[model samples]
Target: MFSLRARDAMSASWAVSLLSKSLTGFSFWIVGTGAASAHVKWFCAYDAAGQPRGLENVLCRDFELLLGVALLWFFSGCVVERTSLGELLVRSINRVTEGLRLHTEVMIRAVCGFFFISLWAVGGIILTPELKTTSPQVGLLQLAIAAGLLSRRTMPFSAAGIVVLFGLAVRDYGTFHLADYPIFLGLAAYLALTGLQKDLFGVPPLDVVRYATAVTLMWASVEKWAYPEWSFPLLIEHPGITLGFDNEFYMRAAGMVEFTLAFALAWTPLVRRVAAAMLLGMFISACFEFGWLDVIGHSGIIVVLVAILADDRPREAEYRAPWLAPAGLCAALTVTLFTYYVGHAAMFNTSIL
Candidate 1:
């Protein structure tokens, strides 16, 4: 009794119903089979205690305490600057440091080539979260840049391009947020500057690389103390990495080890090579447990650390450190880390003691 059009509509509806059911079954199969696993995180953990997290906010409870301790550390630095011991230590360090060699145009070009590969092909394989969503845009630009930067003459354009990307990252992720991973952006911009002229605004590029790496280490290390539970899964999976210690002790010791290395990296180039070597080992060790994403997450740092090793500049000047400089540094580290652990614990209801 139905017309031909009515018969056709009923048949089409039946097909759609079958297709929908099939997709739902496939989704269940994919999830239930352990096909899609979790990734190592790029973002720092948030403070979700009370209020809602708005998109624009950079200050979670943990970072706010981080800022407070930093202010105290800065104040301590100001006090130390006025001491004769500080000047003595500085001169000693200046002498001991194998100050960076001025790069030849050839060397700068080489570094750019590696960075270009990092951005284009490797990045094409797996884009880092830090790269924003514009991989194609960034990759094509890097291709042109590598050609231009073959000599030091075209550095200005590279610098400008880096600046634009820096701005984009800041716009997307607030500059102050730890989760934003701002150090890489800062380092990329600084590396661009290093290619332009004799010195990086009177500072060495290696120094910036080391210092930036140190900052990143210290920043992330605190999270381990603050939210040790986040690392609980790793402990569960690989108990051997704990090396026979109880889990709680292992976490605290691990956090301290990271903090100490980071603190050492910033204190003196005297001990930096040792610290960098240790950090490199730790990064590689972490890669075994977390998988390739850990390596990708830290690749930028690994490149810079390698460059730090390749630097063989010798130092002619050395200074004697009065007892005060080392004492002050030790004191600063102790206070900052102690407060960092307790502050985070207080904020998030984790135990510090």
Candidate 2:
């Protein structure tokens, strides 16, 4: 009996050692190969030792930390999912979703649509080097704009974000730029103005936004994995990989994080707020990096306005800002066109301009 027990113990120890090696090897492979890893390098781990300490470094550090937190959150999710309680909660949530009404579904879909749009922005960052060349002025200016929109009760941030996106598309025509200022600001502003901010706050169905975002992110992630060339590997080697986390591995991991968070929030409200904060943090970082501080300011203003108006439970009449809303939206559109012209004038000149 004693001899048999000793042999079993020895076998178990060997098995554990082998498992450890396998895990380490797997991690290395995940980070060392592809566009996600390259994205990770640009946004999370890029070296900036000799660079001047200004808005640029601050922006880089924030993104690096953001990526690191996302990675940690991903690992923590694995632990959570492995628990019995997590399994139970997940099944219960699925049941709830199955029973939701059409209105609830529409609201969910809208939120999700925005989230996927954000993913496209992130993907653009990884795949297009030109976006990586964004100037600090641009980032800060956007941030300011986002903040302002977020604080405005009558503004639609989603519309604003779309407008901003149009601006960016114009600014860098033919280049894939993943700027989120336009979308986030636009969506948030819309919610604030439409009285929906109060309608959904503290409700169980509020998770529709996150769930929708997650679904899009999950598919996007699969596509990234399926097409490794267009993934992080190509991105990392691109001349524009500026941030540490701008590598293929990291970008993939970020996508994974977004996907996981979206699902996790669907299961638990606790994580929903965290996910929102992460999204906001990313936007803030972008504002500084491109000197698009206006985006940050405008987006933030809209959010605040929504929060205040929501708490006050103001009448629909008070919430409606007919003139300003359209004006802000038109202004956003004009800026987008101007920026696009600046970014693509060269190409246009080469072709037909």
Candidate 3:
């Protein structure tokens, strides 16, 4: 009987050890994949106009499985939003963030100032790492944008400068490349509208930003499905990131995770706040691996996320119909994928199949 008990204890210990290792590997997978969120174009060779993988190739069994999982996760969150527990979470968060919420706009302005200054300091970079230029004038424009952010009165000018810079980037990089960053346009609109003490018709400027952020992330996630090969080089260089998973599978999982989290940003208050916090953490974690470029490139979005987290506004309407969120997620996935594939085909005159 003593020997039998000893054998059972050994078996239980082995199982626990295995479970611990599995959990550790899963954490590393998430962190490593999140760290790669730094634009792959920065670390890998990519042609914005090149033909992407066909939809048939991208919509594999693995992709479908992940999509189903993401849908379930989103639906679960929505269902939670209607619960008293969600409200309690929201209230707790609001209480903690009350001070921050009041100064959210100020925080954004300060961060934007720092971001533009960093761009000026770096020089030759057009908005992000991949969008490089040798023009000295662009650096000066960045400085000017930073200066404009000094005052609310001149913030509109700063916003206009951001739009101008985005246009320049689009002209140089093409719309397909620029589509990865609709958040810039969203920021510009937010800055301009907020500076002028106005909202987009009836919608708040920050809400416009939320929608744009969702669109940007959803669109970029599709890129992972369409161009997972673009990140192959990075995976080869940093194999540890895969945590022993196949590169293709890892990329598919990353894309699905990003898409689901992005969709959550426009969800009910508790859900969105949690999504914002997770994204912010992911971006920050990436910065540890990619360094200053990652920090500067992602600063704008990071600040926007902070503001989202700090936002304590009531959103009872969102929880009223919890079922709609999963349906919306499905619709959003279809539309974004369709738009990306068809738009790329039209722009590059390439076959999308």
Candidate 4:
């Protein structure tokens, strides 16, 4: 059960099962920790039956210190090259990146996924209060843990991992609004589908990542339709303000368009470009409505968009570029305000009340 065979069909099945078990174990640990943290201080007794046996506390602290040290060692190597610490590092990365094999790419994704999972774990520990009170969110946490474990070779797992991480981070920062979850879910779907598919000469193998993205986009569209409040007003909002929709019909029409496009994105890869474009529009609109200026999160999605574009490169093209990754990101930041007023027409209209 522990062995990984390169050829056997059972191997995939077994791996998924084991991965599920591992995820469940981590989920239970997180839930238990969250529950315990709610009542007691970090180093104090967790229950009436338990004593202030500082041994467990000390051991946990020591373990954390060691883990930090080990992570630094591994990450520093990824950052630093052998002889060149300046321009050479950039050139070296670019040169080597031109020929990255599928396995190597998967490994890189796994490393990134692990880093994200670690962040979620730490964040959850800190945000125990919010999680303890709102139990449904724990399902998202569990889903993330499971996805991280299953990300071995499948795109679905990768999608799950990315979405779960986003979910955890959003919740930690107190962004539990319903609209935000779907956006994050959409992003997670994009990441998972694109991350696993390393080869894209033609119609790239529609694996888990693609499937996940399709599911999320379609589901989100369905949800938006079901909850007109989240979709309608924003569609016909004022250009630069959060004034909400003056006309209900305009908002509803906009919702229909968003819903339709989201579904279209699922059925065909060509629609991904359209989806990316729409999302970019929405991001820009968001900036106008609320000067959030959270470039980090915003840029992350843009990176994925750029990655998708890069992946769609033609085989005949000469010297394909990877810098498009950062270019899309910078461009998105500049245009983020465009998406701000999407539902602006509905923001301040109290007449409906």
Candidate 5:
């Protein structure tokens, strides 16, 4: 009974609605399936019968906006150089540590011995599910490295032993999972460099410690995002830790905090030191919820973070304006996460969510 113009308008409205529905569905399918590929529960909207149907849930969240902010910050930082600002910031940090010097002899002993005890005590694959298995060989190799460190006569040779263990571990656990313990390699680098009086690239041992700490955090943070559902087991076992937030929101926010702080550790010396302290606190607190395995697994990085506190900024590291460092961090994270989502979505197709 409607006029031609009215019918035409109704048809147009229906078409738009249909297109909206299709796009929304496609987005959800792509994201949910892609996330599932990584064992993550980040993207999914349940249907009326308590079933997941599409991207409606993730679409409602500001996840994309968060990523967008990272990209924008990164590009903007490229426009500003920190020639003066960087020097000033560096000077301020240095002033705080003025006249504070850790005895190199004591530091090398503590750093090296810490690894020996932590690994020998645990005597396993980093105390995580991924590297759950261990062998007597790994323990014996660790002992050799520890002994060499104590004697100083065979320190470089023992350091090489650590590198050999790295090869064995990669063969056992695969590079993807064992990459979490870059601190092992870092410690090896320290032992080797100090044996040669920091001869390799004239890099300081503390620089290796800082870099190892940063890489460890960033690597673990990404795992949290990709396998967020892995934490649900902990949540169900210890419900009080949720702190009244929804599981998904808490996990996502936690990932953001971790990744942000990890990036900070690499970019700014002052901020990196602060971030290390905060992360050490977080890891310690998590022990109550996850127990001793968590402690042992994180032991290497925790020691490295402490080492960072005792040491000053590395001479070789490039200086950047305080703001630019954070901006570049944002960009790195944005690109990393986006690539993961898009790549997996394409690889797995639509059934994954």
Candidate 6:
């Protein structure tokens, strides 16, 4: 009897150890495919005005399953946010990021400066890789934007220049294509509001950037669901990113993860910081696969995420009700889905079904 009991215990222990290792390995694999988050249009053929897959196709069984899981995960995070554990985590993060917190603004400015200069260096690109331009003036405009970031007084001008560039991109590419990058407008808003020492309707500049980042990511995630085929070429080119899963299922899962993390950015302080940190890691890891374009294109968001991670300020009106966070998440998901499907259909003269 004693021998049998010991054997049973040893088997259980080994099983637990194997499970742990498997999960760890799986996580590393997921992180390594961080380039999966890159703008697919940059690497594949995409028509902004083309009709995306129908809502019925996108919201299939796999998507529903993922949505349920994401809801549970988000609700659990909200519950945790109310506990002492959340407070402790926030305190620890604040303590470790003390230096970063102090220089967040300067760091953001410097990074944006570098990003604009890189864009100028690579000219013929309107904001991102796919938005090509033949005009020499765009490069000069980017150079001016970079130069504006040199002084607090001139940062607003830089912000204006960013807006102008975005407008030009929209003019050339259309609203659907430009929708992939609201983060630029967020950066522009951040620079303008901070430089002018003003706030929009009482919201702080950094918060504006945070909200914009969340929206940008959420919107991008919707694209993955609506047009998973757009990324098929990328997967075909780099098969290793699938991690043994069917390519279609992998894209859906990727969209779920991105949407969930992006939604968490608007949650409690601890949750947002952790989400930002994870996203920052993903972006950095993606650079290894994508090289300079990923680095420069992601530089602005990386800086924003860093600032978010380092932010230690107390939020006066965070979601205190246990149910509010989950409700907000659901509402956000619904809105983005409706807008993407309905809005796209309307804009492109296609049916949502």
Best by lDDT: 6
Q: For candidate 6, lDDT tens digit of each residue in 70-126?
A: 676667777887689988888889898899999988999999989888888877897
Question: Each model's TM-score?
Answer: 0.58, 0.33, 0.89, 0.35, 0.66, 0.90
Q: Write the per-residue lDDT of candidate 3 for residues 127-227, one digit (tens) a residue.
A: 98889989898999899988988888999999999999999999998888899999999999999999999989888999999989988888888888888
* Candidate order (TM-score): 6, 3, 5, 1, 4, 2
Check candidate 6 and list the clashing pairs: none
- Cα deviation at 116, candidate 5, in Å, is 3.3
Model 2 scores a TM of 0.33
Superposed Cα deviation of residue 107, candidate 1 (Å): 7.6
Candidate 5 residues lying further than 4 Å off, grouped into runs, are 1-60, 64-108, 111-115, 121-134, 313-318, 338-353
**Model 3 ranges off by over 4 Å:** 1-32
Writing each residue's lDDT as its tens digit, candidate 2 over 1-353 gives: 99999999999997885565344333422332222322222233322112212223223433333434444554454445436865575456444434332243234233334333333444433112334434444444334433443333423443454455446654664332333222333343334435344444443222333333444334333333223234344454453432343344444444444444433333333233334444444434444443332242224322322222122111233222223333332343334334433443343342111
Worst 10 residues of 5 by lDDT: 33-42
Q: Alpha-carbon error at 334 in model 6, in Å?
A: 0.9
Kindly state the number of residue pairs that clash in model 1.
3
Regions more than 4 Å wrong, model 1: 1-40, 43-127, 130-149, 178-182, 316-328, 331-353
Ordering by lDDT: 6, 3, 5, 1, 2, 4
Q: Write the per-residue lDDT of candidate 5 for residues 1-353, one digit (tens) a residue.
A: 46988999999997885565444433332222111111122122211112222334433344444344433433343333245664565476556644434554455556566656677777664323344345777777777777887766677887798788778767775665465667778877877777767655755776776677677666656555555566666566556555554566545545555666667667655556556656666766665545555555555566666666545646455645545654577676756555444544554443224
RMSD in order of candidates: 19.8, 17.2, 6.3, 25.5, 9.8, 6.6
- Stronger candidate by TM-score (1 vs 4): 1
Error of 2 at 208 (Å): 5.7
The better candidate by TM-score, 3 or 4, is: 3
